[model samples]
Target: MTATRPDPEIPAKLLAWYDKHARALPWRAMPGEPAPDPYRVWLSEIMLQQTTVAAVKPYFAAFTQRWPDVAALANASDEDVMAAWAGLGYYSRARNLVKAARFVAELGGFPETEEGLRALPGVGDYTAAAIAAIAFGRRAVVVDANVERVVARLFAIEEPLPGARKAIRAAADRITPDERSGDFAQAMMDLGSRICTPRAPRCDACPLAADCAARGHDPQRLPVKAPKKVKPVRRGRAFWIEREGCVWLVQRAPEGMLGGMRALPDDGWSAAGDGSGEPPLVGAWQEAGVVRHTFTHFVIGLSVRRYDGAPATVSGKGEWWPIDRLDEAGLPTLFAKAARLARAASERLL
Candidate 1:
């Protein structure tokens, strides 16, 4: 499938718009500025996957401040990185980030090409292209979600996504200029995010408005998406064992859902268990409440049960995390929500 070239003026117009309206992201180097550090670019791109820019900002800042560079990240322990990335969702990305950091550190520096970057863990086509263009000043075409939307709208591509991705990439390739390719890619992203939005696109403010085929049509409907499969709802149970002002928090298995994060002991809830599993302790367990959390594949209702028995008898491969400093334990969002529910129940009992 061949993609027709976009209007020759599109690049210049878009670059002009980008020069004025480029987002002031922590990891981005402004137009005409030196390329951003590859480490920062790589880190931000990994974190930004399926995540919002607003949500990623603090995480980016935190990770960079703590690790500072690829070497530092490589040297950090896996538990520490996983904990820091707890609420960010997608535990695997954090794992891969550490692995890739070690790989890069061993190689002595980041690879400068998309193909080379792709060889690293977690650096897929989009990420490799983004790093190559934005961090290494390469002419690679970078197509992210925002760029996909802008391209789809600009060319009025009507095919549904996943299927339309090929044409979208070709269209993106057509518009990506040889000069300042990184800036061009960022410009398209900024345009899509700020002006050519999913709904109620600001066509009047768009630099590519003159060339956009979807501009006259219902632009919002250009990039049609196939229906999403309904996420299955699952039920589970989590135990809140408290003693001496601290809670029993266990580290998850090294591999699987929410792997390696510190979490409240539970009846194997991570597998979407039927909530019928026995409590870790053999004692009176009272229902604290339920905590609802959504994972990628399923939604779960975790029944928070409190241990009414003596804590001294409960034994496990876990730590006694202070209830007051539960925040520092780096529990995943699901467990974090469960903790809040249990804490409220304990307060009521007090």
Candidate 2:
């Protein structure tokens, strides 16, 4: 793909600004930090998906220290890896992370070209391009959210998201430089994150201010977005059976939503309209309360039911633990939130 030359002064402008004001992040090595490590960059990118840099910082530090390298991550057990990613929300990303690590480890290293990177388990068009350019110093275009906003507003494109994503990608490709591709990619990413913010973008400090179509006309309204699709609501029941200050917790199925994460014993949730399924427990059930949680595409309403004088074991699955020690378990955020609500209500009713 032909790369577009940003205004001759744009790169010079952006790099100068970056030199003075780049956010200090751990994953970011300074200009000469042994060139970019494809393994580290790939790992950080995967973990950063749909997660904020602040939220991902601790997890990234922990993982790098514990595993240290792609080969170490590849050899980690599923349980260990999942536990390490406990509160990051999207469990699938963690699973894919390990899969990709193993694949790359076996192959010796990440592909230096976009096509080769795309062949890895979770690497898509954007990710492949990012790795190819940022880590391997290849001339590839990267159009992440930051880059998209920068491109969309720069050209004053009004297409909605997802629909507009492709055009934005094309536009970004045009501006990427053949030389210093790594620095060029980082420069754009940094510019978008810092100056070209979605709200109240600091146009005065922007390097491409002269070429910015949005700034030239109406910066605030350039990159228009279509309305978001409504997320569906889902419902289910969670059995909060407690005895002697201990709560019953279950491990989700090995595959599927919230898979392998620790959770309260629950009636399998359904996407349908009603929630009348059998409680994932035995004994006379009573309505304790209800807890509601929202996922990206769906909202989940979990009705809390309480069972008293229940047997020590539920026969076929999960484990019961001291209620106070729930923190030690690898529970996802949603379930952990629900558990807190359930326990407080349980205390109130008793």
Candidate 3:
């Protein structure tokens, strides 16, 4: 059961295990049931990318409830969509989701082939393959993080990640069953997530125990990963201007980091400062403290400053939202944490 000589029965044993034990998810159709709707499949795949299942479940349910179909999502405004996608991070995916949805709607439906799906705004290689296989029942090889681990161990490939990805994909293609490729892909994902985990794997319950290449050896160590580079830290300042029971909020520019989302106006995180040392409004400023948040590439510390001057002097396009209804402002987690800090400080005054 090596990479060059994988057991052909791998897919069958895994799929049989899946038929009886596949995790019941809101977006999946059972083993023998009809394939789920393409729109649902596409949406779920998009939401699940780089995100955990538990984190995505509530968001998926809310999005589907608000926009039931591709056409419905296509008709949504960017503001509403961006706001809905606030806490999901990877803000670009939400932006791309809108673009792809509208494209599918105008085209009248999702493309049924891997190549066709690739042409969509956000559908990359993995996403296109998954949608084609899972929704259209196309015999496409779908390899995600979970599948990568499973295949790496099944064939006992010791090549480190990124570099080993090519060999892993090749091995996966060899073992992929032409029939029920959709099921086979999902089965691999389930087996990887549930049985062949990254940490302590439950190999005793594994259906492919006898056929596993890394069975006698340390299976968890296969699919070695490259060392993670440390993320650099950046600092910025967020202005918290409270007027009566309301707080001022601004919409970020339509592109770049945290773009098109509501946020407490901030001096951009630059040494030269996009708006350094200057608060949005001229007022006596009191520093409330700092809130730290980490992004994919950098960590940020945003200093929250409370304005203690005249509110009438503030004139801008941004609105003074009632502090009580701040939840509906769709602030990203960074600013949300800042708001909480500001509220806690304000409560001390009373």
* The best candidate in terms of TM-score: 1
lDDT per residue (tens digit) for residues 1-350 in model 1: 98566789899999999999898999999988999899999999999889999989999999999999999999999988998999998898988989999999999999999999999998999999989998998999898889889999999999999899999998888888999998998888888889988889999999888898988899988689888888888788899988888888899887788877888888765544565678887878889898887777888988998874455756778887788988888999988889888888888998
Model 3 spans with C-alpha error above 4 angstroms: 1-3, 270-277, 308-310, 313-317
Top-down TM-score ranking: 1, 3, 2
Clashes of each: 0, 1, 0
C-alpha RMSD values across all candidates? 1.8, 3.0, 2.2
Worst 10 residues of 3 by lDDT: 268-277
Tell me model 1's lDDT, rounded to 2 decimals: 0.88
What lDDT score goes with residue 187 in model 3?
A: 89
TM-score of each: 0.95, 0.89, 0.94
Q: For model 1, which pairs clash?
A: none
Superposed model 1: Cα runs more than 4 Å off: 1-5, 270-273, 313-316
Name model 2 segments beyond 4 Å from true.
1-6, 243-246, 286-288, 322-324
Q: Over all chains combined, what TM-score does candidate 3 have?
A: 0.94
Tens digits of per-residue lDDT for model 3 on 196-274? 9998899999998898899879998878999888877777899888888888889887778887899988876743332
Error of 2 at 150 (Å): 0.5
Determine which window of 10 residues in candidate 2 has minimal summed lDDT.
Answer: 3-12
